[model samples]
Target: MATPPKPTKRRTYDAAFRAEALRLASESRSTQAAARALNINVKLLYKWQKAVQTPVAAALGASLDPTTAAELRQLRATNRRQAQELEILKKAIAIFSKTDEQ
Candidate 1:
C-alpha cells in the first residue's frame, strides 16, 4: 500500500502583499493568467481575493458583516455623545454645589 502524503502547513501573508495579489487577480484578464504571472496558485489567488473583499474591521480584528459593523460604529458614536453629556451634567452639578455653599 502507498504511504499517505504529508499535509502542507498553511502560509501567512502580509496585508500589503495580500491586497496586491487580490487586486491583480481581480483586475487581470483571468484568475489563471494572474496566478501564472504572479507565480502563485490560482486557488490561492481566489482565497486572497475573498479575504480582501470581505467586510472585516481588520484593525479591531472583528469579522462582523457590513451591516453589523455599521451598526456597531453608530452605537459607538452614540455612546460617546452620551458620555460627553454625562460629564457636562456632572460639571454643572459641581458648579451648583459650589453656589449652594456660598
Candidate 2:
C-alpha cells in the first residue's frame, strides 16, 4: 500500500514577536519604517494597521474612546456572549425540529 503524503506545517510566530509587532505598529513611526526596523514586511505592517484601525473607525461614532484597550475587551466580551447565545438558539431549534418530526 502507498503511504499518505505528510501534512504541510504551518508557520507559528512567538507571542513576544507578535507583541513587539503590535507595539511597533502602535508607535508614531511610518508603517514602512516600523516594518523595516522590526525586520518584517511593509505589506504585513500595513495589513496589521488596517486590521487594527478598521474596528476603531467603525466604533468612532460611539461615545467611548475606541482606541482604549478596555473598550476593545468589552466589545470582544459582548461579541462572545452574542455568539454563545446564537449557538444555544441553533441547538434548541435543532432539538425542537427533531421532536416535531417524532
lDDT of 2 by residue, 1-102 (tens): 999999998656677776678777656357678788887778776666566555656566346553675566568769989999999999999999999999
The runs of at least 3 residues in candidate 1 whose Cα sits more than 4 Å from the true structure, single-residue gaps closed, are 1-62
Q: Give candidate 2 misplaced runs (Cα > 4 Å).
A: 1-12, 54-102
The pairs that clash in candidate 2 are none
Candidate 1 lDDT tens digits, 1-86: 99899999977778887767766765677889988997878888877655654254555554676587568757866998999999
The TM-score leader among the candidates is 1
Q: What TM-score does candidate 2 reach?
A: 0.40
The lDDT values for all models are 0.75, 0.73
